[model samples]
Structure formats: structure tokens, C-alpha cells
Target: MTTETMQADDYFYEFFDAVSNSTDISYVQKGDVLLCEKTEVNQFGARVLPTFYCINFILSLIGNGLVLCIIYKYEKLSTVTNIFLLNLVISDLLFAFSLPFWAVYHHSEWIFGSALCKLVGSLYSIGFNSSVLFLTLMTFDRYLAVVHAITATRSRKTMYAFASSAVIWFISILASVKDMVLFDVQPGNQSMMLCEMTGYHHNIMKKWQLIGHYQQFLLFFTVPLAMVLYCYIRISIRIMSTRMREKCRAVKLIFIIVLIFCVCWTPYNVVILLQAIEMSNGDQKQCSDTLDYALYMSRNFAYLYCCISPVFYTFLGKKFQTHFLKLLAKRIPCLNITIVTPTQSSKTTSFRTPNTVTEH
Candidate 1:
């Protein structure tokens, strides 16, 4: 209450603020007075990441849209595997819808506001979760069709596929709700509004981020990966014993599918897991700077999966390629396209047959 006491308190506060601002590490202040101190951001991301996202967005949109059109235009391509591929396409396309926003976020600030941030972030999560789940489901469907061909044929229904898709979407949306709740627009050190998680406190933010990274590792990377590996391994073993002449190509496609998924996502997941461990274990200062660099590069590569899935679809499905070319011919009028209705032999017993197409 005295004038000298008030002056001393003011001086102490100013000195503390000066020390906090002059320090290298981020500081946590008790009061709401925000300090804008210069901290290093991953400059490589700003320089290179936007281009990757932009290319992913364009290619995924076109490729997925083309697949959807082909599926709708042709009635013979609605097998359970194709249906799952449809879901995968939809998931990737929806996720691709968020890439433009993310490209902007990486290149500059998050000017899209909190609600849009939540929407876009949530969509990204849903897309990724659903994409993984769909791939898992597709592998299982193949397993059932190959190993338990009679049961799969007798029990298959369009309604069953639709119901399963509904459940997948429900689970994916539930997973993404946390992202919507956690993400918001917050001020960064450089006076930029960033759309990211900023907890009510620094400790809470770190805890939540670590939890998120682990959650992604388990759900997206580990569990589905295990399922895919199991199903594909069994499918490979079973196909080897069968009399199908296309066994080599089938096995090759299976390997490519699993390989692409793992190669694109595993490194990114590992980087995040290492970052999470470093944060939780209190080795932030000792962590390698290359971790930050790897995070940027791996993430860009992982995001490419959205565009890459459609490439797999186009390459592996001869019928799909035919339909896709036909669709293109219809649109462009100058290209000559021949239509081929693929006939499957009875021995083809896999879910990829004329019967499977007809049933759907």
C-alpha cells in the first residue's frame, strides 16, 4: 500500500519479465500476460510441406472422384472388396478436403478460425482412422473370400457391407471428436495464430500431446497393422495351396498394398513416438535435431497415402482400370475407349468374381 512498496513490486515484476523473455526455453507465466519470445520453428516445413500437401489434395480429389464415378456408372464393380475400396476412397477424399487448409497452416498462419480448424482437424483424423480400418477390413474380406469361399459367398449382402461401413464411420468420428475438442486457434511466439492443441496449462498440453501420439501409434499403426499382416499372411498361405492361376499376381498385389501402407506411415509414427517419449521422459534438450527434420519429411510422405491409395486401386483392378478409362473417354470424347466385361472362371472363387459383382 505504500508508494515505495508499490515501486519495488513493479521493479521486481519487470525484472522477472526481462529474464523470462531473455531465456531460450519456453516459459510458463502465472498471470495471463503473454510473452512473445522468439523460438525456433521447423523452418523446413514452411519451405517444403505446403507443396506436398497441395499435390496430395489435387491428386486424391481427382483420383477418388474418378473411382467413385466409375463405380456408380458400372453395375458390375460392386463386390465387397470394391465397396470397401469405395469407403477407402471416400475417406481419403474427405481427408484430402482438409489438405488445402493444412497447406495454408504450414505455409503461414491458421486464419480459418477455431470452428473451421476443428472441422478440418477432425476430418483429417476421421480420414486417417477410417482409411486404416477400411484397409484392415478389405484384407479380412479377402481372407474370408479366399479361405472360406463358400460361407463368404452364401452370407454376403450389400446391406452387410453398408452396415459395416456405418460402424466404421461412427468409430472414426468418435476418435476425431477429441481432436475437435483439443484443437483451437492459439498465438505462437511469432505473433501467428496457430491451430493446434494448447491446454489450459503447459503440463496439461504436454500430457495430452503424448497421449495423442501414443493413441495414434496403437490404434492407427500397431493394431490395424497387426490385423493387416495377419490377414494377408494367412491369405498368402491359403492362396499358395489353391489352384488359382493368378496366385502370383494376387500375392504381389497383397504385398504391395501392405508394403505401401507400412512404408508411408511407419516412419512418421516412429518419429512421433520418439518425440512423445522425449517429451514424457524429460530429454527435450538432448533429443536430436534431426527428429524435427524427420517429423516434417515423414509426415509429408504419410500424407501422400491419400493420393497413393487411388493409384493402387487403378493398378490392381483391371476392371477398375477399364471402367476408369471408359469414364475418361466419356468425359473427353476424343479418346477411343473399348469396353471389356471381364468374365471370371468358377475357380476364381475369390470375392473378386462375376458372382460377387452380380450379388451386389
Candidate 2:
């Protein structure tokens, strides 16, 4: 083995941290080969990542599942915006499905076999890419629905939404094919067999890796983020000018979702982009402990988007909150709550004697 090999593993994990092989085994560079010196695991990562994954797994699964149920239960919830949100939930679920494997891997090593490795890696990429795409699309959808209502009303349809979702999912899955093909199970620091990228010819592996990093940064981060900001800016300006109370509320909700998305993902993308560029120098230079720790933390924040999104949806959408309460009331007979739907001139929604009405 060589330092180059270790560097390759680090880069792979930088982009997709949860199940990527850990750099536990320490080594030193010799004249031409690298000799394994000791098995020094990252204690911080070992302690932090598993717990983070477990919590995210529980919250995302429950929250996203409830979101799906609410959407399915109410016809009013299936608008163009909510349709995009539905797919967003589905993508987040895809991300969550991979977390248990990641949780286990963080506590120990990659106990899963080669096929599972490729499957999990591909799923992670698919989920992440599709989720961003959906969010970006949601921003555009909101911009049109708010800014150009007439045109948007004519074009937004259930069939069209499903068609767009299919295209995004197709592209996302296609982007993940490289991960499925390149990653394989290999011997790790100890007796551990780890799953990581291998089999690239030396002449082109560097170029290939660089290209992959650039693709991820562009497709997953830069382009979508830029579009989101631009759309939301225009949306904010348009909504501010309008005196519609509902639109004002909608603006607040959109702001929360977009802000959370950026806060969660931006740092992780930046760190990965910097790391990819630095590693491309082929010097086998290791990153500082500070940068390494930051990467670990940033990746966790990025994963938290899955859990955080449903929380925002629940809190922001009055209809969603009402349905959620009704659903909750069903299980707990003592919570006989009543919900009143909003009327055009109703200034405020009110609950009846046997029920409670909640406003957003």
C-alpha cells in the first residue's frame, strides 16, 4: 500500500462520510511504499457520528413518515409546491434508509459486504442529489406560483409534477452510477474489510477523482444553491410588495426552508470542495486536525437536513399542523381536539366547543 491509497480513501469519505471507510490505521511513507504503523482511530468521530446518525435516523424516519401520511390524507395538501415537498420527503427517506448502516459502521468498521457498500453509497448520492434538486425546483415552483400566478396556475398540474420528479430522480440515479461501479470492499487498517473506491488505473484515477469532486460540487451544491438564492430573493421582493396576508405567511415559510437548507449544507460543500482541490495536488499532504474535525461536524449538519425539513413543514403549514393534530388525536382518545379551516375574511381561525383551532 501507499500514502496515495490512504489519500484516496480520505477523499471518498470527505464527500460521503457516513459509510465511507474510516482512516483509523496510521501509516508512514517509506521510499516508495507506505508501512502501516499503528491503528489509531479518531475518537471524536467514533463518539460523535454514531450518536448523530442514530438520532437523525429516528427523527427523519418518524417525521418523514408522518409527512407522507398527512399529504396522503388531505387532498388540499397535493398542490404543486406540496408535490415537490412530497418527493423531497421521499428523497430524505432514501437518505435516512442508509443511516443505520452508517451508524453501525461508525461504531465499528464496514461489516457490510461489497454489494451493500455500492448500494449504500449509491443510495446516499441519489438521495442527496435528488433532495437538492427537489428543493431547487420547489424554489422555482414557489417563485412562479407567487410572482407569476396566472402562468403558474396554467402550467402546474399533478401529472406535470410527477413527470418532473421522475426526470430529477433519473438524473440523480444516473449520477450515482459511478459510485456503484467504483466502490468495492478492500482490506482496512486492522483485520477489517472496508468498502471504498478502487480499481482505477493510476494514470487516470487522479483525473477521475477530480472530475467527480467537481461534478458533485457543481451539480449538488453551487448550481442549485445559486438558483435557490436567486429565486427566493425575487420571491421575497414580490411577496413584500403584495398586501396579501397568506402570501406574507408563505414568504416566512419559504424563508425558513431556504435558510435551513443553506445553513445545513453550505459548510459541508465548501469543506469538501476545498479538501478535494488540496488533495488533487498529489502530494499526499494530510489535512490539519482542525479541518478534519470541521469536516466531521459539517457532514453531520448536512445529514440533519433530513430531520429538520419535516419539522419546518409541520410548523410552517397550518394545514399540515391541523392534520397532524387530528392524526395525533386519533391515537390518544383524551385529546379530543377540533380544527377549523380558514375562511377568506376570517381574520383568525377559531376552534369550536369540542375542538381546538390552531393558526400558523
TM accuracy, model 1? 0.82
**Residue 347 lDDT, candidate 1, scale 0-100:** 23
For candidate 1, write residues 1-360 as lDDT tens digits: 000000023454567777877653333343443232212334567778789989999888877777677667874435566667778888998889999998898787789999998889899999988887776777677677767878888766777778888988998898787798888877764577888865454556667777789988898789888987897788788877877677787777778778888999899999989888887786625324577777778887788875667556444655555666777788888777777655665324323621121111
What's model 2's TM-score?
0.82
Show the lowest summed lDDT stretch of 10 residues, model 2. Answer: 350-359
lDDT by residue (271-318, candidate 2, tens digit) is: 878878776765444424555677788988988885656555444555
TM-score of each: 0.82, 0.82
Task: Kindly report which residue stretches of model 2 are placed more than 4 angstroms away from their true locations once superposed.
Answer: 1-31, 34-41, 76-78, 246-254, 344-360
**Native-vs-model 1 lDDT?**
0.71
Q: Which stretches in model 1 have alpha-carbon errors above 4 Å?
A: 1-41, 76-79, 286-288, 332-334, 337-340, 344-360
Query: What is candidate 1's CA lDDT for residue 10?
Result: 41
Query: Deviation in angstroms for 253 in model 2?
Result: 4.2
Clashing pairs in 1: none
